[model samples]
Target: MKSGFPSTSPFRLPPWAIRLARRQQNSMAGAADRMRFVIQLALTNVTAQTGGPFGAAVFETKTGRLIAIGVNVVEPTNCSLAHAEVVALANAHANLKQFDLSAPGMPKLTLVTSCEPCAMCYGAILWSGVRNVVCAARGSDAAAIGFDEAPKPKNWVATLEDRGISVTRDLCRDEAIAAFQRYQQTDGRIYNARKGLT
Candidate 1:
């Protein structure tokens, strides 16, 4: 297989998402600034019918330079692994041409997501090598709309910090929740919603 090419079919952010990312690149500088952009991405994904109502990005923690952006593409790509945080981290690694984002000479990286990560993405954050995570909205907010975040240890945040990753939650809280509301209004699919976890 070609280097950096998935052995299977490749999926990507929609054209509109790409265009918007280009337009907004370098326009944000802090956790709050970044959260606004991510929430917009989630809401826009709903409006554009591109993906689920979740958005994430990787940025240089210092420069705040946008590294990569992701909106959930699970349904469209038919890939369960295409959660917003996973896509953003994968794209960030691709842009840096490396799997370990914390490699020497690399600037510190922060992953900003419109909502707190689900169980799968919590693991992804550990492996992604980003130094920090900033989230808007909580798992409960997603569950309110019938999406399951699955099981995460109550100590998940503390665990990340124990591993050298800092966690910041609830940035631009109301606005992020608004993205989920928009998704609900648009009848967005809660693909992970299960009838029973039992």
Candidate 2:
């Protein structure tokens, strides 16, 4: 474990990113608009050289008010679990002060991600208590840029729906894919599990 005690900003998102999110807090309503916001975040993360080109946010399901935002912090935090979706959810929990978003009196939250989540994030959504999931790019888009998604279920979408969490995919897909491509063109680092380990 490589660590010397984490600071207050646990996820370590860029300062500008934190500001941008604050300025736009609860600023989006439509799904396409929200997707655009997160896509921009992903692009900014790449250009900022902070982490990977992935972004995610939590929103109130009914009103579409952005609750919290997160960009990838895997390499910076040296923790693979710091994926965008996980960070977003964790931030939401912290801000809302509720481990289960669906806890009584809590707003029904939605997870909006710039791209389809990997196996780990997919599992996170199931336990996050979010009522809905909004996705921009497909998981294959992440894979094209040399990211590993692990062995996520093929029926993942249906699976979430079965659990009462609605899943919406491809909300501004081309734009999200563009963000991934931008990362690739800029030679952004692609970190995944060390192959041939097990």
Best by TM-score: 2
lDDT of 1 by residue, 132-180 (tens): 9999999999989988899999999999999999999999878988888
Computed on alpha carbons, the lDDT of every model, listed in order, comes to 0.84, 0.84
lDDT at 5, model 1: 20
What does the lDDT read for residue 23 in candidate 1?
A: 80
Clash pairs, candidate 2, are none
For model 1 the local lDDT of residue 9 reads 19
Candidate 1 residues lying further than 4 Å off, grouped into runs, are 1-10, 196-198
Q: Estimate, for each residue in 70-163, the C-alpha lDDT of model 2 and write its tens digit.
A: 8998998899899999988887877776789899888788889999989999999999999999999998889988888888888999999999
- Worst window of 10 by summed lDDT in candidate 2: 1-10
Model 2 vs truth, CA RMSD = 4.8
